[model samples]
Target: MAYSHVSKKNGVAYYLHARVTPTANGTRTMYFFAKEVKAGDDVTKALDEVPAGYIVVESDATGLPLLKKG
Candidate 1:
């Protein structure tokens, strides 16, 4: 299953989505979500509000939570 990374930049929240290219090396592409969460937003609560069949993961680089498909 694919996963989406959630990150906060300048007090705003964004989502990074991974896209795989049909290339010989299978290059991966990252994209940002169209929506943004305002500052002071509860990230943990947002994670918990995710619907079923999805899981939250921590980003190794940012230590932020990411949403992934189960």
Candidate 2:
């Protein structure tokens, strides 16, 4: 499962997702969600609210979350 972290910038809350890649070298990457959420929000619940048509994937090299058009 993917996990998310909440960060605030310029009064806006960003949901960052971390995902692990399945490559020979385990890599992790951080992806920024398209929208800003409320502060102190739950990461897991925020993930479920990701906008439609977008999917979270892992980067082969960095193992970070990659936001892609799906």
Candidate 3:
């Protein structure tokens, strides 16, 4: 199952997704969350857990989830 985060304020479930892109410096992996999984999203790229050294936080105003490097 996709990693999920429940918004404390809104109580909405958000599923985590990841995408990898090639850059001049190197490959970069981007992480995000959505209410539903997209069709083109790779199953392998969808994270099953919070990434190591990272923490999830909520926006104070919007209550949207965010990933923070810990």
Candidate 4:
């Protein structure tokens, strides 16, 4: 899972921070989690199941943008 912040300037663009790990398939893999802005400005305490073999491209989920870049 990963955490990111929303752009204070744009308010729509997202800045993603993902976790990267090496895979045996000869390709690098990355992953992240999605959460809403809650408890004031903290990310949600819970996360949903992200699809396997795919990174989170974009999540206009709530306020924060959950994006995955590899």
Candidate 5:
């Protein structure tokens, strides 16, 4: 598994940095609340409380990093 602190771009969370475990396997990246998240659990919900120009990274990326989106 990996973890990143991504800010929202358009409507999705984008990774600025992450720590990949090199053995993680999943379809969706897991998001965590920086203030209330616990270990061994994954958050699959989208966040809606971000500031107009800022937000914490939602989760660890699930696959090859994306450079852009459609």
Candidate 6:
């Protein structure tokens, strides 16, 4: 199952996703949250667990989920 976080302010659920992009130096992975999982999404893939040394946080103003280092 995909890792999900519910916002305390809005009660909206967000699923964690990881996106990989190629750079000049090398490839980098970025973590993000979305409401729904996209079909045929090659660049972004849903994460089953939170990455090590990271935690999820929600915005107080918008209730959007964010990844923070822990």
| Each prediction's whole-model lDDT (CA) | 0.44, 0.45, 0.84, 0.40, 0.34, 0.90
Candidate 3 residue-wise lDDT, 1-70, digit = tens? 8789999989999888888888999888888988886556443266789999999999999888999999
TM-score (all chains, Cα) for each model: 0.33, 0.37, 0.85, 0.26, 0.17, 0.91
Candidate 2: list runs displaced more than 4 Å: 1-48
Q: Measured by TM-score, how close is model 4 to the native structure?
A: 0.26
Task: Give the winner by lDDT.
Answer: 6
For all candidates, the clash counts are 0, 8, 0, 0, 3, 0
RMSD values, in order shown: 10.6, 13.3, 2.1, 10.4, 12.2, 1.2
Selected candidate, larger lDDT, 1 vs 3: 3
RMSD score of candidate 1 (Å): 10.6
Q: Rank order by TM-score, top first?
A: 6, 3, 2, 1, 4, 5
Give per-residue lDDT, candidate 5, residue 41.
22
> What is the full ranking by lDDT, best candidate first?
6, 3, 2, 1, 4, 5
lDDT against true structure, model 4: 0.40
TM-score head-to-head 1 vs 3, winner: 3
Q: Tens digits of per-residue lDDT for model 2 on 1-70?
A: 2234332223323355433345567654333643443343333233444456767565555454457889
Off by over 4 Å in 3: 40-44
Candidate 2 at residue 3, lDDT? 34
Can you write out model 1's per-residue Cα lDDT over 2-54, one digit (the tens) per residue?
22344443333444343334557766433223234323222211221444676
Error of 2 at 12 (Å): 23
Q: What is candidate 5's lDDT per residue for 7-49, written digit by digit as tens?
A: 4433433323222233346444333333222343242333433
